[model samples]
Target: MTVALMWEARAVTGRGEELLAWARAQELTPGPMRRETFRAPQDRVLVITWWDADYDAVLPELPDPGGELVSRAAHRWRFEPVPDPT
Candidate 1:
């Protein structure tokens, strides 16, 4: 099974681009099978990483860019794909 890790953060006012750049520069240790990033309207950045591991596995996450870049602490979540019935 594969697991997906999601990390999200909201940048401080007028600092969205800086935060996005910081997130884009991060390299996950051990790496992941796939990864992508997205931006929302309100200076929010979201990153999703896919890994060939179990849900309980310890995975490398994006570290804090800096206190000045983000408005608050980052949020993280782990998920496993639902099996197909076919």
Candidate 2:
């Protein structure tokens, strides 16, 4: 099975670029199959990482960027692809 982990954060005012750079600089040990980063209004940053593992498997994830860089703690979620109904 494949699992996708979502990590989202909102940077402090006027520090969106810094937060993006920080998030991009983080390296995951043994890296995920695929990783993507994005930004949105309100200085929100979102990162999604795909891994080939069970839904409950332990996988590497990005750590907190500290309180100074963000408005609040990051938000994370996990998802799996829907199976074909055939």
Candidate 3:
């Protein structure tokens, strides 16, 4: 099965660039099949990683950038793609 992990964070005021750089620099051991990063209006950063594994399989995820770097704890979610009816 394929699993996609989503991680999102809001950086502290004025530190969006730093946070973005930090997130981009992170590396996951064994890594994912694909990974992407994004930013949004409230200085928020988002990362998504695709992996080949079971829904409940343990996988590497990005760690928090700590209180100083963000406004609060980062958010994470997992998903499995649904086949399109065509």
Q: What are the per-model numbers of colliding residue pairs? A: 0, 0, 0
Residue lDDT tens for model 1, 1-86:
89999999999988998888999999988999999999998899999999999889888999877998999999999999998899
Task: Pull out the clashing pairs in model 3.
Answer: none
Q: What TM-score does structure 2 among the candidates reach?
A: 0.95
What are the per-residue Cα lDDT tens digits for candidate 3 across 1-86? 99999999999999999999999999999999999999998899999999999999999999999799999999999999999999
Scored by TM-score, the top model is 3
TM-score (all chains, Cα) for each model: 0.94, 0.95, 0.97
Query: What is the Cα-based lDDT of residue 13 in candidate 3?
Result: 91
The residue pairs in collision within model 2 are none
**Lowest-scoring 10 consecutive residues by lDDT in candidate 1?**
57-66
Mark the regions of model 1 whose C-alpha exceeds 4 Å error after superposition: 84-86
Instruction: Pick the winner on lDDT between candidates 2 and 3.
Output: 3
Q: State the displacement of the C-alpha of residue 72, model 2, in Å, after optimal TM-score superposition.
A: 0.6
> Candidate 3: where is the Cα deviation over 4 Å?
none
